[model samples]
Target: MVASLLSARGLNKQFHSGNQPVSVLSNLSLSLEQGESLALTGRSGSGKSTLISILCGLEQPDSGRLTVLGEAFDGDAGRQTEARWASLRRQQIGVVFQEANLMPALSLLDNVRLRVRLAGQDEDGCRDWLERLGIGELAARYPDQVSGGQRQRAALAMVFAMKPALILADEPTGSLDRHTAEDVTGQLFDLQARYGCGLILATHDIELATRCNHHLDLGHQPEA
Candidate 1:
């Protein structure tokens, strides 16, 4: 049998509010295969972003096991595993958090080119990716020059240019208008399908969530 592209088992995470502990994710388990997509839906504070952070190794779960692209990490990964996760992020994992983390000094096009170069992908297609996302005209603009939604699209363009094997998108369309959101979302799925990459999308948009192959609702989490 083929191993999953990403897997998490018995994951648990919590935070402390000065003294009281607040449970976030409780014994969550999930598996994702290449070419599959998983949607995470819940109200705010329902652990959507938390889950995304954990999946990409930005934040570690209090206790659990996580495997991505064949690299395994225990919940208490700490700083020792950052290099491994960083390598995967540069070449195999693409993350699009709500905040478009674009460099202040780089033009949109340069951001995409940088990502492609880091991933060892051809930079020639960077502009094409931006065009497909409807942001080609703004390629020369800095992040501050564009609207929030446009910056988000630019971020998406960077991710696509990298052609990562796995994508973690947290409200990728949150900043766009309805029409722009539709256009961006279409491109997101199209590229993901063409590349056969695994996707884990965290969104409050029911319509967007329905597009994924699997759905998990944190509001009604299973008992651990």
Candidate 2:
């Protein structure tokens, strides 16, 4: 049987404020299968970002069992675990942050090329991904030279180029205007359908959340 794309059980996290600990996530658990899309809906400070961080292995959960693509991590931050997560991020996982995380020094095309190389994908298709996102003309521009929406699109192009088994997107359209956001949102869905990858995205837009295959509200605040 094919392994599940992602699984988290009894995940917990907290943040320290002065001397007091603020609860963020309490015994949170989620699962995803290939070709599935899950939307995380919650207000600000509701641990949406915190959960995303933990899911991507950027932050360690206080306690939990996490299995991604058959590799398991159980509250242990060993070197081998770190190495495994790093490898997964490089190859099987695609992360799209709220703010486009692009290399300032490289042109958009080159950045996508780098991601494809790191992900062990075909670099020849990198520019094609940019073209599909309506940023082909700006491929030669540096991240700083492009507008915020354009830069975000380039970041998305990098993700699409990698063709990862799982995608984690955080507030993907947070900065764009309604029209642009909708455009980008459509492209995101297109990526999922065409690639048949599992997608987990955090968003405050109820309309967006409803479009996903599953909705998971953190419940720290009113649902979006």
- Which candidate tops TM-score? 2
lDDT of 2 by residue, 1-224 (tens): 54589999988888999999988888888899999999999988888889888888999999989998889899988898889999999998999988899999999999999999999988888888999999999989999998888988998899988989999999989988999889888999988989899999999999999999999999753321
Which 10-residue window in model 1 sums to the lowest lDDT?
74-83
Deviation (Å) of 34 in candidate 2: 0.3
TM-score of each: 0.94, 0.96
- The alpha-carbon RMSD values of the candidates against the true structure, listed in the order shown, are 1.6, 2.4
Q: Candidate 2: give the clashing pairs.
A: none
For model 1 the local lDDT of residue 59 reads 84
Mind giving the per-residue lDDT tens digits that candidate 1 earns over 68-174? Answer: 99999985455669989889989989999877889989999999998889999999999998898888999999999998888888888999789888999999888
What local lDDT does model 1 show for residue 144? 97
Which residue pairs in candidate 1 collide? none
Model 2 misplaced stretches (Cα beyond 4 Å) = 1-3, 220-224
Window of ten residues with lowest summed lDDT in model 2: 215-224
